[model samples]
Target chain A: MEFSSKVLEKAVNEISQLPGIGKRTALRLVLHLLKQPKEQTVFLSQALLTMREEIKFCLNCHNLSDVTICEICSNKNRDHKIICVVEDVRDVMAIENTGQYRGVYHVLGGKISPIDGVGPNQLNINSLVKKVKSGAVSEVIFALSSTMEGDTTNFYIYKQIQESSIITSTIARGIAVGDELEYADEVTLGRSILQRIPFENAFKNY
Target chain B: MEFSSKVLEKAVNEISQLPGIGKRTALRLVLHLLKQPKEQTVFLSQALLTMREEIKFCLNCHNLSDVTICEICSNKNRDHKIICVVEDVRDVMAIENTGQYRGVYHVLGGKISPIDGVGPNQLNINSLVKKVKSGAVSEVIFALSSTMEGDTTNFYIYKQIQESSIITSTIARGIAVGDELEYADEVTLGRSILQRIPFENAFKNY
Candidate 1:
């Protein structure tokens, strides 16, 4: 880990500060940057600085955006009244990729994890509760992953807006489209069986 | 893979250009950066730019340095007459960590790989040959890895300096210190047996 140059050492230290990257990986990356054209480093550095300084969060959904409100939240044709709650912008992108959901998203930023010192207050939970209580929303879909933290956050939000008249639901947990039934975990298999849709309804999308 | 923010996308693209990083990992890293304080991103960007712009290579050995003459080359205590030829600065650092060798190093920059468009001309081989021809160095140790390209680079350099009145050697190839005999590869185990030194010599360091 001993660097011959102070500048190289400083760069490696900064790069290794990132999650999942170690000193060896940082050294390899820095050496690669050294071998590439100087413009590559310039562009990388400039892009990172500009993004960090100028990036904005959507006022409505809390997703990353270049404007005050994100495109999804601002689209008039989309069903903003039917909000799909997610953990972060990545989930927003994932759900958008599916092209199955036309509703707006309310990015929670992260889950309620006590061990990580992250609670409901630190996320966008309060705003979501307020929005639901305002009676403008007709349905709120909890689309976070099925981990303990995701379930905890979902329950917390459900309790907050339970008195509201809007429908509250979670995305169905089932075996993935291409996955074999036998390969599905026990909990997912059991839940899929318990929540089985009508035989004719399965062919409706097809 | 679609990004809601152009700035975030640009930064992810730049970061993903590094070896071993993919778009998903890049997004994770960028999102992590966004969660951190602005100074963290600023410092990382500044450090990368400064390192790329200001880093220097040693005049004699081509190893990375802040000055024309690296500390190893400038030190009078090390034996300048014995040069350890290595693939890059990483090898130099590895050997330096061992603290067993007293000789200075001549970094080859990289091995000769025709598939990668890397030839001896692209490396520091010419300077090493010229240094050897000067008759100041009495022994040249080949410390490059034992890959095909490494062997080719070694033999090529050996042929260049063969006529000079200097001894040439390569680092030993054998089983690692703590490796179990049963799990050792045949070639490595055979070589270890063939190149075994006197039994008493193994305890010399102790």
Candidate 2:
């Protein structure tokens, strides 16, 4: 991993600091950049710098945005009352891509992971609790993942707004649409059986 | 793959332009950067910009370097008369790491690949041939990869230097060290048997 040029070494060191890239991979990527037109590197550097310097988080949902409020939050057609709680902007994007939900989102930024030193205060929990207490929202749906952190965060938020009359619910956990039941984990299969719905409700689209 | 922020989208797009990186991975890396302190992003951008703007290639060997003549080329201790021809700077680094070859290197930058629109004229072959004809180099070792393009490039260079008294040789190809004989490929195994050295030369270290 010895580099003849200090500049190339510095670039490789910086790039390898990324999550999955290693020193050899960084060298390959840096050499690739060197092979391409200078304008490509210019565009990449400028875009990264501009994004880091100018990007903002939505004040309402805490999702990444270019303005104070994100496009989803500002949209009038989408239902703003029914808020879907999730981990981060990635989860928000995933839900948005499905085109199923009409309610807006409340990005918590991350889950409650004590191992990682992330607590409830570090997340956007207080703002969500305040929003629910304000009585402006009709429903709050927990759409976090099925991990322990997700359940803990869900329970913590549910406790904060349980006394209120607002109906709080969680996204259903079941076998994936096309997955075989035999391959499903025992916990998921058991939950699917316990939470079975009416036949007509199961295939409403059909 | 939908992005809410234009700046974020631009950065992801530029990053995905790199080799082996897709839009999803680019988004993940970009988001990881955003989660870290802004100074990390600044350092990465600055390093990349400086490397791309100021990096140089050795005028004598065509290897990536910070000066006109590389350290290996200028060192009087190394055997300048025995030149190891390689595909690029990576091979030079690999050979340097071995600490076995005291000969200087001549990086061709790339092999002759007609499929990729690369030819002899596009490489640093002319300079190497001129150097050989100057009667300074006594030996030229072909250490390019054992591919069709590599063979073609080696043969092309050999034809130019065959008229001179320079000794020309290619790197030995065989089963790698610590490799099982049963798992060795047929071609390499056959070559190893056919080119078996004398008993005294088989294990010089032993």
Candidate 3:
């Protein structure tokens, strides 16, 4: 009987190890690579090797970096006084894409998921508390996902810094920016109701 | 503004260079790696590194292997008389997955695409012809894709080996095995009509 090339199989195995890729997708990718220019295939393989061997974590915030402190932490112009805590580095990219934030970031590595046996101890929470206690930071923003594990992690961090004087905040929960009120999901409507604040309380300059 | 970690960014860049991966998908994969256990992450990185550094092409058939020859080429029990010529290592795989053919394979490295400036000289056709000329081969199967380039390649090889005594054949093309007649696309239906064989003689034994 016929059998696939062991090298192609090995390449497929390595590609399939990525987050969303499966065996079939990996095979397709291998086929595509075969059809691509030889230089492109060689470059991609070399890039994977270099990334695995060269890149490392930032010692300060536990984010990925080539240096001890990440670029964000080392930049003097960035606002070190404000820090945004997130579940992963991808969250940092998401917020950055919005062009609204101007603060350094601390990646918790992941959220607390008891079912997966991940807890506060598994994350870099101590480093965050230490950063807050340093007195250099004035505000800490929790910018985690809205999932159950994310909420549990947010609450844990909140309790950890409850006695500290640094102002702590979570991302607002309400109708999403572009979403129509009439088309709002039940969960979003419910959360908006519970977190509702009084309107028209302050005097307006007429 | 908040930013992704440098190591994560580097990893995403590397992953996105693979066939079919985009920037957003690469980010998702990087985040997934961060969520995995340290050992798992380490294993995946090491696997990628090893795949690039350890895998080598078979000296004989150009298949991937850890040593001088691939498993298929090294196997003594398989048919050494019949060689199936294909465009790449992946075609060897597609044929292998069917578990039908007992012949060995010769990967041409690529097909003949004049617009892309690919010719027989750029392929492994020289090695294939040499292998056939050695007089150990009886039948040579051109199991290439049914495309313009593939047809041009087959014709080129046929002309080059016109004097050789080996019998040559191609994979049959007709209504695909599992395709419904009503839903069959026009191109496939036309090809089936053009290549129609005598069913009366084919069913004589039955």
Which has the greatest TM-score?
1
i-RMS, every candidate? 0.5, 0.7, 4.9
Candidate topping DockQ: 1
Alpha carbon deviation, residue A118, candidate 1 (Å): 0.4
Give the per-residue lDDT of model 2 (tens digit) for B148-183.
Answer: 999999999999999999899998899998999999
Query: Comparing candidate 1 with candidate 2, which one achieves the higher DockQ?
Result: 1
Q: lDDT: which candidate is best? A: 1
* Tens-digit lDDT string for candidate 1 (B100-197): 89999999899999999999899999999999998899999999999899999999999999999999999989989888999999988999999999
By lDDT, the better pick of 2 and 3 is 2
How many Å off is the CA of B169 in candidate 1? 0.8
Ranked by DockQ, the better of candidates 2 and 3 is: 2
TM-scores of all predicted structures: 0.99, 0.95, 0.72
Model 1, stretches more than 4 Å misplaced? none
Clashing pairs in 3: A64-B7, A65-B7
Complex DockQ per candidate: 0.92, 0.83, 0.25
